[model samples]
Target chain A: MPTLIRAEGLTKYYRRPRRYEGAFGGLRTLITRQYDEVRAVDGVDFTVSDGELVGYLGPNGAGKSTTIKMMTGVLVPTGGLIEVDGTAPWRDREKNAMHIGVVFGQRSQLWWDLPLVDSFTLLGKMYRMSEADYRRRLDGFIDLLDLGPFLDRPVRQLSLGQRMRGDLAAAMLHEPSILYLDEPTIGLDAVARDRMRDFIAEMNRESGTTIVLTTHDLVDVEALCNRVVFIDKGRVLYDGSVVDLKATYAPHRTLVVQLASGFTAARAAELLGPEVPGDVIADEGPTLRIRFEANRISAQEIISAVTSRCPVTDLSLVEPELEDVMRTLYGNRTIAV
Target chain B: MNAGQATCSDGPLRNLPAYLQIVRGRLRIAMTYRQNALFMLAVVILQIFILRKVWTALYGEAGVVNGVALADVLVYLTIANLQSWAMQDLAVGSYLYSLVREGRIAFDILRPAGFVPQMLAHLVGGTLSMVLFATAALPLVALVGTLGPPASSAAFGYWLLSLFFAFGISMLLNLIVGLGAFWTTEIGAFGMLFTLVSQFLAGALIPLYFFPDWLRTVAELLPFQATTFTPVAMYGGQLAGSEAVQAIGIQLLWIVLLAGAVRLIWSRALHRIVVQGG
Candidate 1:
């Protein structure tokens, strides 16, 4: 596999307020101002190859944004080396910027007042696009993103989903080989979120563009990503596939069954006791919940077994969302030490 | 290769304009919001009007203080208003803060091209915007100056040197200020510090000649005077020959030193930024 990005021993630190004291220890100290060092990105090493859609996952303040910033060359790393497309990013920013696109979910790169088309045009100029080539990309992105309705609307008038699509298009307008998106699907509705995931899937399959993104929405990871990297407190807790994350954390799925009225929790457990792949949660009133290993007992076999035992009014099967899995991964660690 | 050149070389910048296009694109952005842009223009004009009023009040009481005539003050003040726009050349806050917040600077940092040259691209765009607006504001100031008494030009050559030196100083000052974003929070404190020093020492409120001799000497040595006071003083026939040369020379020397300071600060700041999280 061709390596598109490689980072070695990357680290970043920030000064946190240590005390309200002084540096000179005179009038300054009496006022009480002091700062402590915070290591945001600490010695992380990873490589992303071409056409890889890597889901960079972490809890809040897990140095995810910091790591992305350094990788994108937005912030200079205090130590180690980061080479994107075989070049030092911090050394020659404009040249570096030309090759990559960045999207920040909390912020909009789209021009707020201008129509989407006009913003794209200005960005075209920023990327130095030829008129014909710009038109070509615009046409393709417009079609793929389903941006027909809001093309002429001012970016401010766009829905969050629309704005995100616009952002993704802008990032790709320069035909950057790599894209670093920090929370691309944030604040998006389910419909829009699904659309975004679909669009990303198509892009990865088509252009072979190398993408590294950090997102809070774990479904986004399951929907689009094949690989996942989880970070917590400046360290990588897990790096592999979504399959790996699920297998490692809470390796069971939940099945809730609603019976026709009179079913005791004990009797329900007793009926399905023979097929207990794992634990049974039986305290939801008329509903009986069972937890079982998916790899051990198939969901169909358990559901069928439950239906035969009790007159099943309703039954639903759910695996743990990537969100809960991440919570478990990061929540298990303590920051005080 | 006339039109086709844009196609063959259409690399990462197909979405963005190249080199000269960045300049034009910035100029377009500046003019896009007519109300906000004009509001800034009006604020600058309003400043000129207020300064003109105060200078008139002072010169009326004293005919000419320290060989500087009343009309000279009027013209010098008006010209200073026009020149103030040049401060964009070294805008410290925008340069540094933008990179930190957006993280777009990362793309720039990893490129094969020289970093400073690329940053200069954005700097060039900003300066062009300033120059365009300042040029438009000039005729209005000139028209108002005609309503006031005329000033002498005995220090014409020295005055020119002073203006040149002021440009150098302002640019260097901006570099110093912009560097603050590397080490500090958000840049509010840095902006306050530069604004306070520039306003008092650059003679924006009062001319340097109006101050006591000892204080005037000290202010002249500082970088702030190199921005406005030295230029304004020369316009009012304040210096000539060696004095003018020193004023210009000192400003250039400061520019070099400040540029060096910013670069050193930038390297260290970048390391701190990457190694330590903010």
Candidate 2:
């Protein structure tokens, strides 16, 4: 895939007038020449290729939204370079906007008072869509996202889930080559979130639309993104495949077993200790938890060793969660990617 | 992908239809508040009633005061009040300010349309809604005060042209004030100050003819008069022939100057856009 979005040492610094506190602070803040500068996005570099779904993950205030803003032409970077589809977003904003669709999860782009369909019609006109094409796309989205029931309802009258679906459909109506989703599933319920994730995946798969998603939802990243770019404190901490990230940061998987009558956790732990290369812990009554590196040892071997020696009635495997991987990464900043 | 790129061909004229659609959308939104519009119309009627009684008492049965007949003065004041109400409370500035403060301006910036043109369309839409109310108030003009034709058909033509220019100047000024949000998050104070000062100077509160000579001269030097006084004066024949044409010319000049200033300030504001919340 060709690289469609590129950022080289991108930086954004905000300068706010020094605000004083207490007695006459407001007056002092107005007159002060001194400014406190904040480096919102400092020296970040990354590239997103065509037809790729990459999760741009970060904690709160981690510059995820700032980087997305610069890419979408909403903000001019204070330093460095950014090019989207060969156009400098800030320089040729309208031109760049033609080839990109952006959805900010927190804000609805639909007109507040107009019916949902009217907003679609207006966006179609704004993008200069031919009538036939507009109808075709609208009908297609209405079917795909199940937006028919509330299509004529005013946006303000729709529930949060319904409004979010409308926003997603609106963003994709233009059929741009790239889509930027800023926390697209921020406030969605489980069912709505699944629908959103499925729609995002379908767009990338069927239309080959390159997507850059900024989200705090790890489940979204795991479900939709093939690759992940992790950032913290205004810099990229890790950039690679999601699988590799898990292997590197969180390699341990736990297998829990409930032994049948007359067997204790300690007895099972001792029985499995010599056969498997893992730390066996005697957990709650009659349960033994075994932790092992997935790459080094197979769960089958560990299970068999425990089942043969100990009378086990119930067993369950627990895979490492992306959330745990992130917690580890965020907790220990020194861990090399 | 290439099909989408075709829409980006750079031409201001090509995007006019799209901008008009935006105007239509905003107008539809403004129409949703029918109760608000009716309430405002009632307020305007009450204002016209009070002004008529006050001016009548002041005239003391005189046929004319200051070389202008009472009937003509009544028409001028009625029309001036209507125009003032129509042009006031432009949503462009306050709309932009709130969008910026709430960080919803990101959606506006993400569109394929130019920010300036979009705002211009919104201003026109908002003003059109107000014009609807103004049109409804026209029947009341005959009921409460005297109504007369313009000085002549030719003068009427000039007044129409002057009114168009007046709209342009007013909307551009509102847009310039809106763009101030890029530098300062809160523009409510500044917007209010601008509205009060401009309305007074534009002779919406009282005719420029009633101002002290020095103050009238001061009002004439500023652009506010171009918004209200110019069109009203032309309609009343207070400015006639070459004088009316010259006044219209001054309005056109102000539009050009204000438009240029909007462009300058907007370009600077674009680079300074800071997403407020995150």
Give lDDT: candidate 2, residue A145: 95
Candidate number with greatest TM-score = 2
* Candidate maximizing DockQ: 2
lDDT of 1 by residue, B1-278 (tens): 22434553535544333455545545655667546656777776787788888878877889887787777777767766656645534343575566655544444454434445445455666666777777776678676642232125557666666676666567656766665665654766657666766767777767777889898888867778778877666665565657767777777887787778768876776666542222
lDDT of 2 by residue, A1-337 (tens): 7899999999999998899999999999989888988888999999999999999998888899999999999989999999998878988888888889999999888888899998998788788887778889999999999999999999999988999999999999999999999999988999999999999999999999999999988889989999999998789999999999999999999999888978889877776666688788897689888889999989988888887888989999998999989999789765433
Interface DockQ per candidate? 0.33, 0.47
TM-score of each: 0.80, 0.93
Overall lDDT per candidate, in order of appearance: 0.72, 0.87
Q: What TM-score does structure 2 among the candidates reach?
A: 0.93
Q: What shift in Å separates residue B193 of candidate 1 from its native position after superposition?
A: 5.3
